[model samples]
Target: MLKFENVSKVYEDGFKAVDSVDFEILEGELLVLIGPSGSGKSTTMKMINRMIPHTDGKILIDGEDITKLNAAELRRNIGYVIQQIGLFPHYTIEKNIAIVPELKGWDKKKIKARVSELMEMVGLDPKTYAHRFPKELSGGQQQRVGVARALASNPRVILMDEPFSALDPITKEQLQGELISLHQKLNKTIVFVTHDMDEALKLGDRIAIMKDGSLLQLDTPEKLLHEPAHGFVEDFIGKHRIMQNPDLMPVTDVMNDKPLTSLPKRSPERALSIMRKRQVNTLVIVDENDVLLGIMPAYDLIAKMKEITKIEEIMYPPEPFLSASATAKDAILVMDDAPHGIIPIVDENKKVIGVVTRGSLLSALSTLWIETEESE
Candidate 1:
């Protein structure tokens, strides 16, 4: 967890990069900072690892003031990914990722194993790229290496400063998708800085909009889209945005349209691999045409992992599901019955189209209550 209390950054020239910022980043949450050029979004993120030390107020990591901690050690414990790939060209891909752990004095075997695991997680085959230099890989591949290197030490907090801005559209989209899946699986606290509003909406659990170095509004994506606290926030999000009453909003408005799924015929090992790669605890089972079959919670699959071969044999019936016509109210009512805190949204034909996660449903209901209180 990270907390900022009246934080600000002022240089010798009297220019304030960040001014009186206050927000707490929850553990395992991905918070995005977005604003126009010179908005201090980047500065806000840099202050997390003391990359840009704050001039005033306190920045705490799990209650420990960052200024009191050693800057070098703090940085090594926090992952950082920048727009430009920062891998050392002379060092092999494996060595590049192993840098942090090596600096921490990890055993050779442990570092090697961790590097290989991370490479696979980022979609780079360690067997092929481990010994290869950064120059040999393409831009996207190099960027993947950069991500792997940042995640090498398995840091709990990751600071990504417009990391995908430099990539081509196709690769950028791909990396964003991967990052989303990775976040779901790993649940690392991430503070991502992006100039793109669309990127912030898609990636952030909660977004903080900054302007002229001051924190504007910090809220969930739905909260920002539905209720912009400041005129600048509204203008930044665009006037064309739909202004829906949270009480009447359908589950579709807030649900994750892209839910991770798996086939029923996979072996426990194969199924487990998919879950780990996707970074999900529950896997929705679907047929070839993607019709809902059953639900496989990670615990159930693991318990039966050695005993059974096929996951289909142990998958439970997909109950407590949300129909396509379901509203946010319906989701809230049935959430407690969800086996793994996941309610799959199925169409009339029984095809899984999306999912209303516990967190999303709770946020919607909370927003509804808050609005009701203000109206009353």
Candidate 2:
């Protein structure tokens, strides 16, 4: 656990970058520190590793006073990822990831194995990327290597300072998903700092909202959204909440309860009539209970109307279904793997509630974009 007690940072220039702040980061939790520029979010995080000395208060890592720990030794045990990536331009990917383990004096063979494992873990095959320089990879790939190097030592705690902020929106979302997956599998305690509230909401277990160097609130993302502690909290989250709405959108809002064209059995004539009458491209297959079984495209019907005997034989399961409450952003992310541009929304009983299509999500996103622009 990491504990901050009355932590305050006052620069030598007599500016109070951080007020007396207090918080405890539980083990295996991803805590996000977020606020506007110069809100002291970064200052609080930097103090933990003594990258910047605090003027007042103490920080304890696992109950040990960080002030007393050797700076070099403490940093080695804590993984750090920054927006700059900071990869050694001269070093190969293999050498970059192996830096810490080498310092720990692991044998060459062990280091090689560890580096290979890290490389593969970060989706970089050793044979392909291990020898490549930082400049050889794309921006996203370089960031991936940066993350791989950070985790090279398997540190229990990680500090991410807007690690994905530099990437394009699509790349940022991809990296965020990757990071979430990695965190789930690894269960590392991560303290992430970001100016983006949506990023914090999607990634953080708990979010700390700061303003003018003072922490306004620290709570779960859901709580932060539904129950803002003050006007400032409300304004900040409310403004950015829509960008993260795709992840929070409920499946019930988009699923089709009485699908215009649904199939119950293998009757080509009936299916053809429904498809032609409704002028729909796809038909949902359901059992007697109205449970979604699969979907059959109208094109498939045109080709196999006479050949196929049963809907089950021709129908293929939809890519994947999501809960109504899931944000559209998450659905879109899932759609990256499924270019179909539609996601089935299921209820608690696993019954189809509605369908959120690319068009529907985009419509909702457009409103958010307009509203956000107006607010700014």
* Per-model TM against the reference: 0.67, 0.69
**Model 1 C-alpha lDDT versus the unseen true structure:** 0.88
Q: Candidates' lDDT values, in order?
A: 0.88, 0.83
Q: Which ten residues in a row are the worst by lDDT in model 1?
A: 239-248
Clashing pairs in 1: 185-279
Among the numbered candidates, top TM-score falls to 2
Encode model 2's per-residue lDDT on 1-376: one tens digit a residue.
Answer: 9999999999788999999999899999999999999999998998888899998988998899998999988898889999999999999989988898888788999889988998888888999999999999999999999898889888999999999999999999999999999999999999999998778988999999999999999998866776788999998888556454655544444344555436567686678777788866667676766677887777777788888766677877866768756756667777666434556676677667777666666776777788878877
Candidate 2 regions with alpha-carbon error over 4 angstroms? 239-376
- Model 1 alpha-carbon drift over 4 Å, by segment: 241-376
- Candidate 1, 160-198: lDDT as tens digits: 989999989999989999999999999999989999887
Assess the local accuracy of residue 196 in candidate 1 as a C-alpha lDDT between 0 and 100: 87
Predicted model with the maximum lDDT? 1
